[model samples]
Target: MEWKTTSALSNQAIRTVGRIVEGSHDITIFSNTRAHPLSAQVAGIDIGRRTLTLRVFCPAGNIGDYLSDGLVSFDLEKINRDDPPLLLCFEKVQATCERIHSSLFEVRCTLADTLLITIKPGGVRVPFVLGMSASVSLDVYTGLTISARLCNLSVGGCMLEVPLEDSMPLTIHQQLPNIYIQFPNGEGLRSKGSIRNMRPFGRARHVAVGIRFIDLDRDMRQRLLYFITESEAELARRMGMENRRAGISPLFLVSPHDKKPANSNKRRNKLPPMAHAIKEVARQQHIILHCLKNERPFPEDMLYDSADTLLHLAESDRHQFLYALRYLSEEAAWVRHSVRVAALLGDVLPTQPGLVDDAREAVAGILLHAMGKPLLLSEHLPSLDTHLTASQRNLLKHHVEALRRQLHKVGWSPGPVLNRIVGDINERLDGSGYPAGKRAEALSELVRTASIIKIVDTLTHARNGRPALSPLDAYRWVYGNDGYDKKCLTRYVRRYGLYPVGSLVKYTGGFLAWVMELDREGSPRQVRVVKNLAFQDSKLDTVLADQDIQQIGKLEEVVDPANFQL
Candidate 1:
């Protein structure tokens, strides 16, 4: 087929195509006859070579015969439906093919003869020179939080303007733990980013740091696009009004606007009730950790507030809290673990007489108990399976002292109740624990309860190189141990069943599911089947009732939740 072609592609066109290819958009490959069109997806792109690698969905044997003439045609379509319609058609493009698997073929094609038309604008950076405040942490361990102003923003990344003093310690390509931007509505957006470039700003009074956002979720991307579209419309309207008032003919009569998707009005993606709670608690814990690492005094009231929130969540719906722990992001294991322990403590502590008054303080202490570990260990943080040298073990023990010093530096005291819980939570009944190494009587009831909760969480969750023990195994380990108080351990076991909520277990017939609820006897009552008997992920989350379990067979064993990304 004869086709129009461009000698060179513009930067905008290149960016648009890059996004489409990276997004893995489906494209149709056609030969001379449109009757036998082969469906394909863009797998990879080589910008320098101007070539595209496609995973074509066709019989491997048929692909060789289909591309025998070494020519194919396809179209690169726009990624967003909201964007103006745009299509870049490649006509009779030179091609080659190879078998990837049974029904998949790998096709490589060079865009030698291409027709580029109706190119949608991409990577349009809108200036946000207004007072858009942002906090960027250069390193998670160092806790170096730098204040910056939003200079310009786009869907991919943004440029921040920081004072020269604040930019002194930054390096190019340094991964930032988080970039928190406070929007006009007082909501904050947290993202992981890396420094791409740095240069002096106007007058050299400030530095312009370019950051590329990494792994932005769909919700974040939509928010950014909405902001950019609104800003562009505002700019156009302002310019048009200015020109009309000055009695000068407008350069362009019509203003540009985005045709947003129907659901674009929705601010954020709807997460499950439990997932939303877990996310909020995790976000708060992250901020608290950041403060502790930086040696800054966070709002003291926030501790009690968050503790109360956890307590309420645990009391009202302990099962949901337990199940939601699996949804936490994998960035900060310590923080996630702390939240789990604290929530568990909240659920278990209320049963003890006279302990309800101290439950809030106990939960707060559990949350911040390990806040100092990241400051000291940094990259050397040890896991349960890590074989630590004597010196490393001793260093790890000093994290308690480190936390005390940190609290003292901030001119805050957690009070006597919180102090005991934080300081002696690691101490065991048999004097085997570290720091103080208090014996049975020396460790208070509160300390004993929190300690059991912490150990149970540590053993049940996978970390570093260690495979997680089953809930029953973790409980057994603690119950069989000497340091734990039997009463507290029994309470814990009663609260969380042998196969607790969030436990990934394999039943008879090779079916894998997550324990969702338990009966009075702590036996699994409800489960959500994630994987079928063939070990393939189930398209639908099929929740099985107690009766359904009998037909599926007995509960075989608890598998590591990490393996299934539960």
Candidate 2:
């Protein structure tokens, strides 16, 4: 989003704490500190065959302390200070001198053995256990019954050394009934488990498979804590496992839904004001883009959170308003570019009555637009090859039909504007667009708007690398005769201007400052002169937003290299 400057303020630090205040647009000064620094503390202990050493450090405290001992336990005393204090604890122990049983060490598996496993239906890989801890539920598909032991497990999928009968096909609806595993203490984590996987082991006598809890409710998850804790303790006892010692890698577990409360002890973390919410929406949009690339379905709760945040931001901060639009576009690849294109195509609406609703529907459409990609290798998205056969294009066109079918199953019914936005984000008014070559009159204004945003988003990524197109350059590109709808484009350009406020720019007069707010004449005012004449000076050192653009008209005409000189 763009900001305008009127120059009444100086050297102001804008800290966006979105989760602190909901709906209200308010900024309060907490301290006059030039820069606010947050701190993190970390501690580590290393255990070798014969000894152990411990150390702790605090960035905020500027303290480095160490203590060492043999098989001794201690507690960390909480330190209170003016600045927020963080605690990080870590430990490492060597394996050479550990008193581990050779039998336990030789938990072996042979070739031709099929291991039983279970997981969420249609999930790709099992969770990787070697990294951070994760919970998985294992269930029986037909009976719809769940195992208490396998219900929610913290272990990486166990290895089974038993051979499976030909009766098990390892298909989507099939299960392998028997698998066994022995923990370090000779206790069985899972014995005679069924169907997570049953593929024959390559050359070894064991088939390594994955299992997830099928009915792991909150209570069940809580119960699994004891198992996890005990497993960690047992592993550590035998292998001298300590912090930094990697766990067994498990297969990736796909959760049934997404969006949990923010993982923290603190509850009631109030939502941030409109401006802050807008930034977060943008951040989540990027995260969505990442999730889609990996074929991971968007989490339901995250979608709602972002949607709510956008609705609030659209009330004010129109310049940043398109961020919500961008969020939707990322969901549907065809419409993925539509929101930015729409925002670039028209002015911020005087009213945003159903903008959020429109955005939500559009996201669903965009997400399904490329569903056929995975069905056909050539069209599988993120496809970058220059050459393609006619068959591949035909295969790609089936995505919309596939999209409709899938959405119907999920009870999604998009309105007309949304339908067009998703359908024609790839279309052109000149009848040169793809998917459908419909012209301007045939498309809804909302759809047209989405298209323009899509184009801008494409251009943003294409032309801009470390440095993006200047506001003027962006406008020039979009407003040209061959560009998007001119009337719509002009309205958008005027409001956002060549360079919106808050952005750092270098003027023709060679002054460096942040654009503060716009004036009646649509000119930028300086917020702070980070440097003047390419060098820092006493006058350019502090924040200055109290000055008006009329006082610095010449400097207002300049545009710095987008991201550079900022």
Candidate 3:
């Protein structure tokens, strides 16, 4: 994304331009030295036989942060190395490759697409100095319509060089709400700001409105920052200004402080509930699904690399997990399942420091163990649950083996302990499991540990139009006369207590609570109330941030979503 400026040249001259010589008006030195647009400093410019070579450098030689991807052939019809044209425009050249050559100097009209700015009329451009015009639509809070221009462009919000008459009251500032900078195609850029300083040109019937971006929503902020850093370098290239100083410090938009309610103390006491967290998870999961559906990929590490992250998610820190989950899309269903599975396992695992690391890894593995579903489903329908039909079930039976094969393909060996876990996730100690009919004695600890994940997965979805198996019912089904290894079941109950963490359930009193931590009594005895189902008086009720569970009771009344207040 390098941009250079070309000087005024006549249509009938071919002169070889060279670097500026110090202290003398002498010109005849031929050097292809170029300057940076962010900070005008002479840099090595190599004009390749067929390409424009640009070499950007850091003062400390750390070129790691700079990247550009806007380069094309220099216009061939405009100029030639052997017969250089008199009038030429030297604009910033942007591309990934590292070459600029004499052969590429010819001017091509189509080259306008790669160039960021053009001084000529009707040319789309980025600012060289602190001035540029951005076409924008402004909606005044008073239902007034006005066309606004983003001028006086800087790293912060640009000045809305508005065409307002001096007769307009200066107090117009007080009535202004937040203004949105609409993009070219009517999409709003994240550059939302407020009027910071205003100077009215009454005689000219215009106002130089200074706007300071209060809350930049990521993308627009980055664009402004990039432009700021590149502006000075661009100026140097255009004027052939050789006297360069250190680059100007880039500016940033300051975000406004969020307004909080007057009763701050009560709000501080109310943490976001598990349901809120789960809602975030759902939202984030949908995002991931959307991204995948659009064929976009997120960082692989975010998908299934860390188990401690999952454990922390189940440990009353729903905010972090929810943030993480928003980056995932529904297409990454395996990753979604893995996160929930690991979160559930985190609840049941021993919290002892010595075993925590191992437990986290185990949970991570189980959640992602069936990650081959997407691939499997492409050739054969995916059966992620126990309720698949006979044909679908047969097709789904190959996932464990497929997972092992994929692991090997990627050259990852999580050690034999993990290997054993994957090998027996589908195994039942009663010799009725798929792919393996191993008996109780043959089932290793790793297998039993992996089996807990199966139990949780089964129990979580058992009632959502899939089936209605409670944790207790699930336990009985897995350990009863028709169940698998009783010893494994007993170990699970003893290890994780009765109700696992991350579990959402209702009590006898009709209150709903998510299992937070196992009570000393076991069986998910202690929980956090997510919503007060009985509190129907909106006047008495406050926002979630100003809520008080004690006003109702120790437990929450859980109702169907159709009947829930929120």
Which of the numbered candidates is closest to the native, going by highest TM-score? 1
Q: Write the per-residue lDDT of candidate 3 for residues 50-122, one digit (tens) a residue.
A: 2333333234232222232232221111122222111122333334433235222221111221223433443
The Cα RMSD in angstroms, rounded to one decimal, for candidate 3 relative to the true structure is 19.7
lDDT of 2 by residue, 204-262 (tens): 11122344334345654454444554544332322323433354312222244744423
What is the total number of backbone clashes in candidate 2? 68
lDDT of candidate 1? 0.65
Tens digits of per-residue lDDT, candidate 1, 1-566, equal 33223333223223345655664244766443212346677777776676778888874356654464788666554334343222334546678888877888889886632222222345465544111222333443343466776665677787776654345345567778778765433445678898886643322234567898898999998877776655444333333322213431122133246233243212122446766666556555544554454445554655676788888877777777777666664436676788888887888778778788899889888887867665465345423234556677667788899888878886788888888988998899999998887899898888888888899888987654567788788988998999999888888887787788877888887778888888999888988887765755554378898798776678888888567655
RMSD from true fold, candidate 2? 21.2
Q: Sort by lDDT, best first.
A: 1, 3, 2
How many clashing residue pairs appear in each of the predictions shown?
A: 0, 68, 44
lDDT of 2: 0.37
Lowest lDDT 10-residue stretch of candidate 2 = 106-115
What is the Å distance of residue 414 in model 2 from its true position? 1.9
> What are the clashing pairs of model 1?
none
The weakest ten consecutive residues by lDDT in model 1 span: 243-252
Error of 1 at 63 (Å): 68
